[model samples]
Target chain A: MVAAGPNRIDPYLIPALDGVAYGLLVFVAASGLVFCFGVANILNLAHGMLYAIGGYTAAALLDGGWASLALALAVGVLAAAAAGVLLAGLLTPVATGNHLTQALLTFGVALAGGSLLVAGFGPDDPRVRVPAALDGSVVVAGHRYAAYRLVFIVVAAVISAALYLVVRRTRAGMLVRAAVDDPEMVACMGVSPTRIRAGVLAAAGALAGAAGVLGAPIIGPGTDTADTVLLLSLVVVVLGGLGSMAGTLLAALAIGEIQTLGVALLPSAAPFLLFAAMAAVLAVRARGLATRWRTT
Target chain B: MRNEVIRWGRGGVAALVLVGLVVAPWVVDDYTTAILARTLALALVGVSVALLTGVAGMPTLGQTAPYAAGAYACAVLGSRISDVGVVQVAVAAGAGAALAALTVPLVVHARGVIVLMITLAVGELVVTVLGRWRSVTGGTDGLAGIPAVRPFWGLPVLATDQARYLYTLVVAATLVGAVLLLLRTRAGLLLRAGRDDETRLRASGHRVPLLVSGAHVAAGAIAGAAGSLLVVAQQYISPADFGFDTSALLLLGVVIGGTASVGGALVGAALVIAARDWLFGVLPGHAPLVLGALFVATVYLLPSGVDRARLRPRPTDVPPVHPDRPAVREHAGAAPELRT
Candidate 1:
């Protein structure tokens, strides 16, 4: 894997770290989509718009310097969650077990939201100002890397761990999983599947929002950012198998590496490597990498 | 006797529409004529979407990939070869079919949302490659100055806007007629049956994937021909012309026209094109917003599409079988009989 140079460590380490960070960002964004699909049975095509909204909010708020970076991130995430809940409310009436309707409706919402953002923020790319505490680089094995990236990696890892625990160990998480497996049975058991779906959608929105806020610096926020992120998230979610968290994580990491390393190694062919990987994976396993959520 | 009269009436209406299209350039302004030609070209794309998503039940957002391939093929071939407009269209169809063949294997087994995502990924990949390969596609600038199309036969070239409009009208109508005929065939029935129940189709010993692949190839050919016509109309081809937005718009047109009816495709395409042109002219920056709102409203309020509104109750009209309903068994222990 090493290049034919004395200073090969930086070249290898940079892409490796970059890939991990990018993967973690993708997982953060896609985890919400997976949860929404699994629990709510709603494939929210507008999830990307939520990410962009969050990034734009963070970009706007963080510039004020009235609160700390953590507070700004919280506000951004909360705003996104609120927006998600509102969207969920609007869409619930129309969802009605029709995947095509849900897809089209959400796609319309994405287009509207994207256009609104463009109208508000203009078409220029917006950059989020990283806090001074995480602005500098740190030496790792004699190679300096962005401190914000390390923070993103650690924060995303912690979030992943917490998500796993919440889904596996909590009663609410159990209910969500049960609801995903069979909404009718859950409803029969006196659980309001609609409420659970709304809550899960909100949580997913929060995660996407948080990802947007943290990842804004890396990916940058622009008019087309939502569509780009949505495409990547779709790739991740499909490869990971619609409702499988583990599948999403594994797929996100694998795709992240492919994207970064592929770009690094072959710039011209990099754009196609992600789709090629997906095609190859689907060829071997038509249902994707996981078969746990095959019911839908 | 009544059925024959109805059929003749339908044929007469089609003939009138064809006549109107042929005379549109003279009746309308040059700008409207251009828009009419564009709408016809786009309506051809809607027909392809109708065949795939409406008839075969394979929803794809990647139809733009094949469309782009066809446009690029036409542009390159038209630039290189002389006096072969019909041949250029054939080559473009071949390019689209080749792309469909390449991607169908990856997408055929997946259903619903997975199919949408995989196709979208395929489209993005194509667009990315086209954007990067600047030497051929001209990157973002796109391929311009395409040679004027030469009409077939040892005849003079078609130079007037009216001539171009008539040519495009004839081509689009022929393709639409072909699609309508195809839909009445046994293979078309099998394709629709496969959409309702792939397992049953497979049990009956039909190759579902092969049928789907064939539908996709047909769609590609139609879209390719449309792209070729578009190039001939505008004399330019660009990546922006065949992006995700275009795919979404085409799908919207298909849904609006009513997926089940052949005429719906043309109606939907015309509505979308007219609405887009008018909205862009009126709102300028907010056309997408209006378009988006239209999509949402159409999905919510007009689920069966404009065709349902225009359709009148007839004695021959039978209630569609709900595909979601399980087949009933004759006995409690016996296997359920196939519904159809």
Candidate 2:
């Protein structure tokens, strides 16, 4: 029989680690959304499809033993970035203020991607194991934790820091922010909105791909993973404002904590709790804090 | 004069199409009939989506959820009683209307992408609940063994196949006809105006929100009825029937067939349904790719719906058009343009 008992203290520590890991994952996922929504004003429903593409590419590499784990992941991220560029090219023309068309088009892509994945990989779920080098757990605060999780946390934090720096301190970031605030003004200054949009979308896709490859080990690559990732990313974006990367990160962390806490405190209600939280947040914060923050 | 002739010809063609549709089941095989029935059922749902998306400019991506509500309502009702299709349909419609009423207040104010997201969430919520709530919804396994619909009269109605097809045919035609009539009324004009500019509609001293909510509820009721009819035809109701893909398909069908016209929605449903059956039978593995390509192509080519022109009807009668300049008629006792 499966062991049924109250949660232990050591396991509680695991939840905290899980929360951090998930938070970072959410940050990477929502960062792409920040670029698309903030810079392009496109509610890309296909964002999750890109995430799935990354995961599936990594799975293919790992399955084929074409490279070492790190190399495979790198390849996966690069592949996803390439796919993102292609998607950007196809979508940029149609990504105007027509949100319904954008939503429907991306949804079509997602559905097609999902069905193709299922057709290719079979209906059964696929799992990607941790690399042997990072499989063991390390003792921390009297609790054993997976080393892979720790690595994920550190790497994600570094990436987020780098992304923040790039946005705040770099010229590209200026163009991105300017584009978000006033695309017409940015264009009037002689910068091609198309080029900026392309670059941001590519960057977003790369970030999503990297996150997907990294998350594959924890969440596993599967048919429905794309949908789940998309929903979570959307929830994060909604919690944050339309165009704020900082808000996206903060909301991601909050959502990760909620997920971990829900699983720990109320397992039975956990499934419903996520959506309840989303609805509650949307109802309360409708336009998010950034708009209000700016006004104040 | 030419415009009148064209209008008359178009009306005649529509009547001929209706006659062809009424007799379609008898000529086609059982499989084709079944597919046509399925198409009609989906066409009903598509009409509802058209009303929301086409007329009201609301991208409601969850018609399938309400559709499933109707299916489950009828399934539960039909299982308890004998095959009282009309009563079950009424119950399903009521249930759907109730559900739409509950959600419309919150949803009516949301526009553009937000509306899409919220309706999607609602759809997902319903599907998840239906899948998990085993006691009421029969959970994942779903309700099966629903009795087949019987004829209203006890006459051995052509072994029930043609009869069932005719029943669906009548319902689909009647619903389409009713929608057309409604669209010609003053309320329809108001709806169209509201769709174009709710601000202007409000400025005109009309209660815009109430009108929007009313449209939503009515669309929901129609969608529910369609779902109930679908279940009656299929003899089963599964959570899959109400899934996200169904919502997407319904939306796509509306877009492809042309959104604002009931005839367009019906044609779209027929095309999608027929194409799916044909493609699945022939190239089963390539269906998604084909469907995806179709969506992309349709969006690219027909950015405006296919029947956008037909959506607005022309004035039936017209004044005489003479190319030659007419002699000016003078007022009262003046000469009749003798100077010209």
Candidate 3:
């Protein structure tokens, strides 16, 4: 986008606009990661496959109508949520073990599940049918922008606001948070921590599924979709510094801009930007969280 | 009496393996020999993964970064600078060590999953660069037609499968022996101490971070040498050779090999790599499903696991406020052990 003063349209505006939607999409996907890894302390590596479950559901079911969208949303969320429950069950054996054990289990599930999905869905990148009303691009400040992409803005905001309320206001969220902080106390208070774990996984899956359906038109469903989503969500989790809502939102926004506007500004350096940002952010975070064992 | 049998069993296995390596080319088909050579290179990389994960307590998913660096360095060097195997390996190791030294600060302080994540990021960064650096890395199509390498300046170029396999075998065995010897020294003891309890190691006035940095560079060099071997064996190099799938398999192989044992790492890595390669060839699309199921099954049935000290859920080890864990805030002692 060349610098245009008065008469010409500013090209940065479109990417900047797209950046908001992309950031919101990332926020929606990453919240589930924060819930599982951040709140529950479960390193669920298959979170992306769960999101892909929803993406595939959207691609297979949606036919560009409101009712189809609803049906797809319901089926996608339920299927992904069911997968989450299955993952929770699978995790039971190695749940108390170190992160590597959990990683082995989760990554196994992801690889197997992802392969089965490809086999079932056919080895092709299926297209998502956006709702008929939002199928075409809308003119925004002289630039035509895909209307389907804009849906992430309001949906993500509502989801984040609702998530904030639940974690802050609801009794269930309190138990979940308390379970993470002190499981012994939660057990003493007559709650099964296992149930909380399953619930958290299911909730995380739902969030990922919702994002999958909503963002499918943008990210799409393919063999590599699960991996890409997983990595991006991980980056968001790391850059967000883990477990903080405000931090996660800001980090998602920063990543979204770097991916969109940053790419526009420096096309040649596009591929390196995300990982570079991730490496730098993670390195700085490590220094700050330098082990308490240093002087213990 | 039990000790005698166990020791004899280990010795017998070692002797059998040595014999097998020596006569592998004579018994196996050319195709199998090529696969075995590739697996040998990967097994060497697996040794490096073990050096970090088993000995240093830093689980990684990014050693592929250095592996790729070494492979590309060897490819470039073999084409432009030298086609000598030893020289390529040395250059590749240097490239890997240099890369590791640069990224040491990013990974040195962290422990547990954070280290895994950071290393994974590092690997991904290298991959992205390889896929995009069109003029140099050939932009995902990868650098093909790499020249054949001579094992040494005076030796003939390895033109046959048997010769290539033998060269790879000799190099891998030498590197593995060196790593095993290194682990027996004081440097290895200090790394193990740091892994067990960084606080205690620090209190004793040990430079824990420096030890980690050294280990990181050493592993990088080892992985880099493996890269040169890969080029010599395959005569082609690609980003896919050092991808996440390879890294994951190698890491898991090291775990299955018994993280603390170099010989175990070589065997474990060879087994997993061989299984994956064989499965891919035989089952085609069904490889991942079968492998995934096996990993999950291994986690449950073999609960004593790869790192027995780490995987076995001991109440005494994971204290409520254990600081060694990456995320110290979580209540790790929540889950009840299915077995005592």
Interface RMSD, candidates in the order listed: 7.6, 7.6, 4.0
The CAPRI class of candidate 3 is medium
Candidate 2 clashes: the total is 0
List, residue by residue over A81-153, the lDDT tens digit for candidate 1: 9878977887777735555667667778887888888899877887688877777899877788899899889
How would you order the candidates by TM-score, starting with the best?
Answer: 3, 1, 2
Best by DockQ: 3
Stretches > 4 Å off in candidate 1: A1-9, A64-68, A287-296, B1-20, B306-340
The CAPRI quality class of candidate 2 comes to incorrect
Clashing pairs in 3: none
lDDT for B337 in candidate 2 is 9
DockQ versus reference, model 3: 0.49
- How far off is residue B113 in model 1, in Å? 2.9
Clashing pairs in 2: none
Each prediction's TM-score versus the true structure: 0.89, 0.86, 0.92
* Global Cα lDDT for candidate 2: 0.71
C-alpha RMSD for every candidate: 6.8, 9.0, 5.3
Which prediction has the highest TM-score against the true structure?
Answer: 3
Of the pair 1 and 3, which is ahead by DockQ? 3
What DockQ do you compute for every candidate structure? 0.36, 0.20, 0.49
